[model samples]
Target: MKDIQSLPPGPKPHPFFGNLLEFQRDQLKFVERMQRTYGDMVTMHAGPRPFVLLFRPEYVRYLLTEHPRDFMATQSAGGDLMEVLGESLLTIEGEAHRQQRRLVQPAFHKKRVESYADYMVQYTQEMLDTWHEGEVVDIAQAMQQLTLRIVVRSLFALELLDQIDEMGRNFSQMIEHRRSLLARLLNIYVDLPFTLYGKRMSAKRRIDAFIYKLIRERKAEGQDHGDVLSMLLATQDEEHPLSEQQIRDHVITFMAAGHETTANALNWTFYLLAQNPEPREKLLQELQTVLAGRTPTLNDLPNLPYTEWVINESMRVYPPVWAMGRKSLVPFEMGGYHFPEGMTFLFSQWVIHHHPDLWQDPNTFRPERWNPENDEKVQPWSYFPFGGGPRICIGMPFAQLEAKLLLATIMQRYTPRLIPGFPVVPKPRVTLRLKHGLRMKVERTATVVKDSVTMI
Candidate 1:
């Protein structure tokens, strides 16, 4: 082991708390301040538990890809999340993670995910139908609900679509409670009314009951529903079949993972487009030309490079998964520095996305940087919005398709204009989101063809 005092330079510790209070106050701003003050790397503590912050792309790549096993994904909540989520991909590790990834990989394959294109377009349209033209809408809230419905319909089919309202309310209460002080202490084990832990368990029970009911119905029907549920249930011929608990865990995990990230991605994409007029116009032009006043489908993606660019750049600017860290299992050396074992070492997408050296004019929303002609100029791990390495998000293909189609569908008919004087800031909890919901004024346009349908 190396000397603790020899670690990289960082902001002065605040006696007992170190940087914990500052970190808990506003992590994004703290990270930016650290980056400016300490350059590429910093060593600080969260109440005496010191961690390293690697803001450079080179360091991030080594930690995530080259020597991934040297670090473990979860630092503090490994046991906690596993208790709630089971041995699902997010919780599992080593060979177990590999096997689960293999089992779930096929469902998200490009060709397989494209089959759900019609569902994406249809569900998005259903959402837009509820919005009155020129109404002030909270785009963030709207996208969350829209993506939630899409997750249900696309992954499990329409059997549960009608129950979305009740489910959403229940889920909201549960998630909000999960963030409370009492719930964090209980950590998913405790149950019963008067406490936060109890409320969370109740929420989980409601959610679990709903999930188990879906599983029972799917198994009863015994017919393929052409969704994720059907795929998971079709393991009859396999030597190793998923247990009831395993299936339930996976369904709940996907429900939590799939919709939330995509919702934020869509939310930030619209926010970026609204703030930057030139790219917004460019995206609109590309949509009009390629889509020809029709809703977009997965097949039409290649022709809409600018649309893809916009989403990519938007994620680069405001990544949904803003930061992630791993606990160092063993000591390591790189760039003439030591990473002590048993300490948490973390990196932020926000830090890398805006790194001065890695990105030119990193603050600007320049979709053109993603153009093929300039592709080689970017280094790996510099713009990882959905994570990287073996544990990269399994739903990447599905999410990209969903975002593009949703963008084309909505932009084809209306442009969501941000309401003036509404302060926009990110609340980077679990996922990066608007501090106050994104308020937008929806203005309908004649760009869409009323009879148009997405071409298969």
Candidate 2:
């Protein structure tokens, strides 16, 4: 094994805090500066733990695909994810992760996912119905609420409907609590009402109570509701039936993963489109010609290539999951440096997607870069907004479908223009969010309106 001196170059760290303060100060900018100064692989530290930040596409491919078993996914927000997510697919590794993935796989099958399109379109229309011309709205929050409703109805098949808003509030509060740097660093667990950790725990309790109640009801009914919860309740290994907690874990995982990332993606997409009128017009023209002011269906997705490209480009610019961490399972050497077991490695979608080596003008919002003609030239892992390899997000298909349908539905009805001089900043939390939220004024579109559009 190479000596410690063989480690890649990076910014000097503090004796005790290491690079934790620098990293927490501004994670995106810190990484970008490191990449620009230190090159592809840079050794850094977070507290006493050493970390190597990787910026190359090949390194990403190697870690995620070539040597996946040598590393495992890391827990985010200081291991508190386990307390909230339980042993669901997001938190586990190795055989347990595989088994849980197997049990949950059928729920995301193309056919099964496509069956939810009716709900996606219906929910988008319901949200749009609330919009009025010349009124400013926080599009970010709107997307979150819209996706929350869609995910609840489509995945849990919950009919209470009214409780969805409460559920969404709790989930949002839990995420906000986790976003607290002090809370994460301290790993706080004080159960007082005023504390962030306490608030987080309270949110978890409410979410758990709701999910367990649903699981118990589903078990008692023993009938297919044609939803993910129903499917999980029905499927069982010969030797091992899924426990009530297991079911709750899967439901919560889907509830959090299903809606939050998609909402951020849609938020970024609208923000990008507002800033780039040329591409926005191109996307609008595609919606006019293909969708023709009618609601979009699953079949029309293939016809809307530009719409897909716009979403792809937006994700490249502001990936919802901006970075992911994986801890080494055993000693391994990568990029000419030896890494000891338990070393944490981070790869940023923001860095690689904006790297000059990958694209002609990486920072420029250019949708045409994703055209079919350039597909062959695009490198593997170069634009992994949803990550890569076996653990690549299972909700990718669901998120893509939701984004396109929502974009089409919203754009066809109203044009969201960003309020001038309103600051829109990307805040990297569990997902990349707008620090101040996206404020925009909605203006009515001139597309021919059908008397009524029916869901398929």
Candidate 3:
């Protein structure tokens, strides 16, 4: 506790508020400034709490793995997520987390998750089918609606294709309110009228009622459908099965993470592809040669190396789950400094992914850098799109396969181009979303259609 001066250097704190004000203005820019001015590990304060920002991959490896037990996931950072998601694997710890993870792990296994590829491509095709040539569309919104429907269908075996518009309308309203400042700062779940929290809970209940109704239907069916809900229903032992509330938590967790995170990845990938025609062209070529105008499958995944690289590079630029905050559960020691318990530790995917030292041309969207022929090996703990270690995202394979299938399926049918003269920027909320969403014009591909009619 007495070694405070040995901590990493940072901007001088305000006498009262510390560096909280500066941080709130623009978190990404402020962290970038801190890394440049004070090196990789910068110490800043949120109010009176000390937070050390760790940027290096070695430091990331150390914190998430080597000294993993010394720190704990902070509720302050994911508290808002908890209220909306309840106590599924994301917010729990210890034996409960392990147990829940074991229950859910089977759903994301390679064989099982891969079997859903047809559903992935089918849903993607359904969405693309609605998009006529020469039509203008918000690709980001399109992706959100698409992924939400995909997750709902693939996870629950329920078709929301026709109901997507209504479901998405309510879900988006809920998500917006859930991620609002009042919802985050206040951390109150009560439904108060004319307030964001109130609206969020209302929206949540709409989704919840739907989910619980489905759960009841599935329960009454008394047969396994091989969907996630069935697995939850099947789980029980000498002890006890999960309560309805717990199952709802897991369902909501999957709904938010499965749809939201993957949609952001797809949205940003197309955003980059719209600008970088070379990579996009190469991607189309791969789909033409390998897939030959057909949709991509898990079997084709390994063969489409360039397609994977494009998404990798996109994530490197804009990781969906950026920045993780944790609290020291014990007196923590790392980077040659000592910290007492309860100190905050901050890690930024944006900072680490863009660190000039780790990535050459860190700001450049060059997927070729990741090509196997280039012999480019990502340093351990450096490129964590879905995080790392034992607690690394369970849905990683699900997301990767889903994104690839969607990209390949859509790219086979249309060439997406960003609308001219629209400023696209990152809106870093719980997940990094596009500010105005990716507004783009879609042109039918010659492979899928002969006409050059535009979709905008």
- Which is the leading candidate under TM-score? 2
Instruction: Encode model 2's per-residue lDDT on 1-456: one tens digit a residue.
Output: 456568899888887678878887888898899999999999887666568899999999998999988889986323467778888888889988888888889989999999999889888898888888899999988888888888888777865457767887899877777535555556656777888778888999999998888888888899999999889888897766788988888889899989999999989998889999899889887888898768899899999999999999999999898888898899988788888887888889989999999888889999998897876367888989888888989988999999998898889888899999999988887788888989999888754436653321
Of models 1 and 2, which has the larger TM-score? 2
Model 1 Cα shift for residue 202 (angstroms): 2.9
What's the C-alpha lDDT at position 230 in model 2?
Answer: 89
Q: Pick the candidate with the highest lDDT.
A: 2
In model 2, what are the clashing residue pairs, if there are any? none
| RMSD of model 3 against the true structure | 2.8
Q: In order, what lDDT does every prediction score?
A: 0.79, 0.85, 0.81
Report the poorest 10 consecutive residues by lDDT, candidate 2. Answer: 447-456
TM-score of each: 0.91, 0.95, 0.93
Q: How accurate is candidate 2 locally (lDDT)?
A: 0.85
**Per-residue lDDT of candidate 3, residues 196-248 (tens digit):** 77877777788899989988988888988888888888876446578889899
lDDT of 1 by residue, 134-175 (tens): 899888888877778988876788745677767766655555
Off by more than 4 A, model 3: 75-79, 178-190, 447-456
Error of 3 at 402 (Å): 0.4
Q: lDDT (0-100) at residue 171 of candidate 3?
A: 67
Error of 3 at 189 (Å): 6.6
